[model samples]
Target chain A: MTHKIDIKNLNLYYDEFHALKSVNMVVGEKNIIALIGPSGCGKSTLLRTINRMNDLIEGVRITGEVFLDGNNIYDPGMDLYELRKRVGMVFQRPNPFAKSVSENVAFGLRVAQFKNKKKIAEIVERSLRAAGLWDELKDKLNRPALDLPLYQQQRLCIARLLAVEPEVILMDEPCSALDPIATMKIEEMMVELKRNYNIIIVTHNMQQAARVSDLCGYMLLGEMIEFNKTSEIFTNPRDKRTQDYITGRFG
Target chain B: MMKLFSEKSIKKALTVIAFSAIAALLLIVVFIILEGLPFIFKVGISDFLFSSEWEPQMGRFGIFPMIIGSLVVTLGSMIVGIPLALSGAIFLSEFVPRWAMRIIKPTIELLAGIPSVVYGFIGVMVLAPLIRDYLGGPGLSILAASIILGIMILPTILSISIDSLKAVPQSYREGAFALGATHWQTIHMAVLPAAKSGIIAGIILGLGRAIGETMAVIMVTGNAVILPKSPLYSVRTLTANIALEMGYATGMHRQSLFATGVILLIIIMVLNYTATIAIRRRVGKK
Candidate 1:
């Protein structure tokens, strides 16, 4: 399997407190990988480190490297903006810009300085279709994205990232605020999306991980306890901590 | 039962206190209208508003010059102040470290604590001379007043704008940056648009301050009651006209000054309403 992202012996610190300790994992291309753990287990922190999203926080320090494709993203000469473009993130809550649906999708293209109006419109439609939002949102393209229902808004956010044509999509609890139906819809979209792009999701729902992820990693206290095929991780966890977590004993 | 009675009495007292503030404002509005409107009718509305002549002793009380002066000076101050205040707000909110911003913001706010006379004093002693030596015409001109007023309104605009910018959710910035937007691009495209209504409200409030200011304007504007030909020409604002004349005027002349006060009140009310409408529209859209 071709490794799309290689996280090598990564350690992260927020001031004096170590947030992620000696974590390492390789994510395969065009597949869904889920990271499951309780809050403060550093699953989100690990995910953020992949795109240097943690760099925005003050007093954050990192050692070791995250390699995207073949390039070390932590190199001194790496362009932060370019790295983020190639690895986009969807936040926990749906955070659509206070703009029209079409404009939200077109934002990334505009940031890349794509100025042709016709080309932007084409890309916006394609991105929305890819995120499975075109049929419901086609006539409402000019309406404000914030005015949409929460599920549609979340889909709009996904379309926004798709517009930039990223290689990897990181979701940080993308459905925590959503109802079960909405969560299921996003999970369905994720399974479809992994056919084209690598998806790494941090989810609290163990069933969600089982349902959508091809591979799964269980984390405990900034440590990746076990990583294997989703069925093996769920049905026959290797580590005691992973077994305890999957069985609802403790996290 | 005794505790309940006291609680009811306390609520009544607080309600009376709040309504007293409203009652005071209503009294002032009533007084200004009563004293000003009769004089405006006596002089004839067209002559009072449009005629340029203003020899109050000779019973020619046209206030066209001061009206124009107030409008021009207020507009000029906005032009000078908006860009500086906006950039300062962005820098403080986005780029500055927390430690540095805490110190710098309070220091800038100290500019507001300084008295208006002191601001006028600096304009007279420093700015006016620079303008006179470099640009020609008298040191006290409309340009000088505009610059001074712009500086005076800076703290108001800066304080409000920084708050507006800071109020934008951090999620928007994260979303923009995750899309490969540079810091400037993120601020300009995402953060700024969300804060537009608030920034505009700050600007209009600053404009209200510029127009209603009396003492500092009187000290720097040369108090000339003429139709100014240019920014460099000496002029008198409505606030300046009222303050400069109210000390020693009889009957109709005093009423004319009150009429000028009425006009100033109207301009300020229009500005406040515009701010209300702007904020209301933003809420309605959401």
Candidate 2:
């Protein structure tokens, strides 16, 4: 019932290039909100703004308010480390560390100074299971993470994030690097994950958005063209552009 | 009429050119072993390797002191060099801006071109005297040799490490940041481990240079043939032994210097072999 994240008039720029313009959206609690757009439409930009991951780029400028848990994340007093802990991200490519499978899952805990070896092992097991990779990976926990197949590597990246217990998960083209079967597995995992955590995903596949998300937003050229319930947006979109986009007329 | 060059002929020519370097290495190994092995056998490998005496007239030619000298100096160089090189590489690759690195990287590389003899001269004039006055040993001691050699090998370590650190993909950094890890934590946990193999390779290469170097080490290490008791004590490395005595030596004594070269050669091969195995173990993992 609560809006877990609230963005109002969010504007972002990299040097002189305006990357996101007036992006306003309410991300409801425990729901998977999907952003669908053509490439370079700023869907990924909007997702990065939530976790402040875009701050790493030099010459990036932002003039907006992003409220997370009712606190403005852009406020000067905000701790970046704490904010990032609450908002985890999965990249377009799976980037598991060049470490063993168990170590990859336990890295976040180790950084947080969680010293109990038994607890770390237990949590590693739970996180991998949550990512739906436990059945395939349970016996090979000590094997190098890089040796895993691409799908398992991606799942390991998810388990890495999950181990830190983030409240919001941001995924940018998470399944683009994957084939259909692995994509389906991840899509199902995301839907299951929404029972506990707020999820925001930026994706290119319209079918994926229509299938997995409860709420969907269509964006074009750094602007949000439409936002509605997934069923309503697909069947009875009020915007001519949204209709055109869904019906394969234009981006 | 123009004639076409066949791919097979070009490939064959290039293979021969590529293999010539290895063939030359084989020739050198053959020559050194032919000259030195006889003397080594007569002296007994253990006596040549483990005994400390080195008197040519009295028929004693033990090289144990030189072996210890080389080891101690190389160890000292590593002690001083590895930390500085690693930190410099990390700073260059991670902390410095692109524009700054453009200037700094080339400048760090330029440090490698200074000749060894010039380094030796500088060490004699400055570093040796500094150590002699401050650290309480004769100016020419193992410590002086270590300091100069450490600086000499810094560029090799720095450049290789920088390349390896830079090879780590940007995605790893993003993944670590997303986990709420701080900048230092991301670098320490993610970047360092990913770049470990490269860093160790650089260290091994530097260690090789430290062991093989002769001029600068001899000038500063006082060239004493005693078994060194401490860093403050004077010593003579294997390379220094051959370089200093090869011109005056004859018969078994001359062959003993070549025998020293054989030992140096074996040591390098062992170091390189270990490096290859270590790197293979870390290939895709890093």
Candidate 3:
């Protein structure tokens, strides 16, 4: 299978604190890959590195490579705008823009320079439907996005990402802020979304990693301890650390 | 044992204190009116508001020219000061690093602390001559007063605007960036819109400072009791008129200076009320 993203010896630092330590991973095309680890294990940091969202933070320095498709995204000549357009991100918290629900969905497409009113409306409807949010929100398109319930807001954020038509979607604990029902809905949406796009998700729920992801990568202390198919990783694993973590021996 | 004290007595005492503070402010307004009413009645309200001629020695006390001068100079200051202050605020809040913000924010605060007299002296020695040479005429014109006032209130606008910009939540910026908007685009569309009312309040506060300023303006405004035809024209503002004439005048003339004070107070009150309304409206919208 062709890889959608490849990380080679990627290291990240926030000033003196080493966050991600020489992390190497690959995400296959049109498949769901989940990074599971303890808190502060650098799962979110690694996820942000794919879209270069960490570039917004001051005193952050990254070494080595994160490639989207065949191109090194860290290259000096790479266009950040174009790179960001192709690789969309959803944060742990649902952060819908302080705009109307429809506008929030249409924001990414607008940024990509789609100015035609009709085209934007169609994309907004399609994206919302794809994220399974259209049935509830179709009537309240003009209401502020903040007015929606927390679960709907999370799905709206997903719709926002989908609207831009990105090839790779990086979700950093997308369901962490959600209740079990909302979490299940997002997990289901992820499985459905994978038919059209590659997905990399960092999640704390081991069973969720097993249920939703095609491949599971277990990380610890800023290092990837195991990478294998979800079934094998759960049923049989190579690393003792991965086995210990998966079996709930110790984080 | 503490609950033995009657709640009514405590409530009455607190109410008295609060009412006393408000009463004190109202007393100043009353005093201004009392002092100025004699002159205003003698000069006639229409003549004071509309007449151009102002001669204390000949007993002609028309305030139209001074009022016009104040409006012109304040408007000029708003034009020069608002954009610079807003941009300074944006730079401090969004662009500058934490270490740089530490240095720059205090420097702007220090600018606010400098005495108005020092600003007056600076305007007289430096800006007056520069204006005279560049724009011609006695140099100490409405333009000179405006430029000085602009510099004086810049710190007020910058500090307030920076605070407003900083008050915007980080989620707004994150949301915009997640949508693939550039930093500048995020700031322009989200951060700036979020902080618009606060920025407007800052501008209004700057205008209040510009309007009420006396010493710095008097030093550079040529002290001419004439309607300002242009920025280059030497003219006297209402505040300057009161300050310049108060020391020597007695009776009605002195009272008229106090009347000018009342007018100045009214204008400031209006500006402050507008700012309050703007802030409330923004809050309501959110």
* lDDT tens digits, residue span B1-286, model 3: 5665667779889999999999998998888888877777778889877888777777777888888999999998888888889888898899888889989999998998899999989988999899889879898987888888888889999999998899888877877786779888788877887788888988898999999998888888898887666788899899988888888988767777887887788899999999999888667655
Name the runs in model 3 displaced over 4 angstroms.
Answer: A98-103, A132-149, A235-238, B2-19, B33-48, B51-62, B248-255, B281-286
Residue-level lDDT of model 1, residues A1-251, one tens digit each, is: 43689888999999999989899898877889999999999999999999899999999999988888878899999999999999999999888887889999999998999999999999999999999999999999999888999899998999999999999999999999899999999999998898899999999999999999999999988988888999999998889889899999985
Best by DockQ: 1
Work out how many backbone clashes candidate 3 has.
0
* A1-251 per-residue lDDT for model 3 (tens digits): 44578889999999999999888998877999999999999898888888888998999999999877778999999888888878888878888876789988988776767889999999999999999989998999998887788899999999998999989988989888999999999999999999999899999999899999999999898898888899999999999999899999987
Comparing 1 with 3 on DockQ, the higher-scoring candidate is 1
What is the TM-score of model 3 when looking only at chain B?
0.92
Candidate 1 lDDT by residue in tens digits, B64-158: 99999999999888888998899999999999998998999999899988999999999999999999999999989999998999999999999
Which model is ahead, 1 or 2, in terms of lDDT?
Answer: 1
lDDT of model number 1: 0.92
List the candidates ranked by DockQ, beginning with the highest: 1, 2, 3
DockQ of each: 0.76, 0.76, 0.40
Distance from true position, residue A234, model 3, in Å?
3.7
For each of the candidates, the C-alpha root-mean-square deviation to the true structure, in angstroms, is 1.4, 1.5, 3.4
lDDT of 2 by residue, A1-251 (tens): 44689999999998999988898998877888999988999999999999999988889999989999789999999999999989999999999998899999999998888999999999999999999989999999999899998988998999999999999999999999999999999999998899988889999999999999999999988889888899998999989989998888876
User: What is the docking quality class of candidate 2?
Assistant: medium
Error of 3 at A64 (Å): 2.9
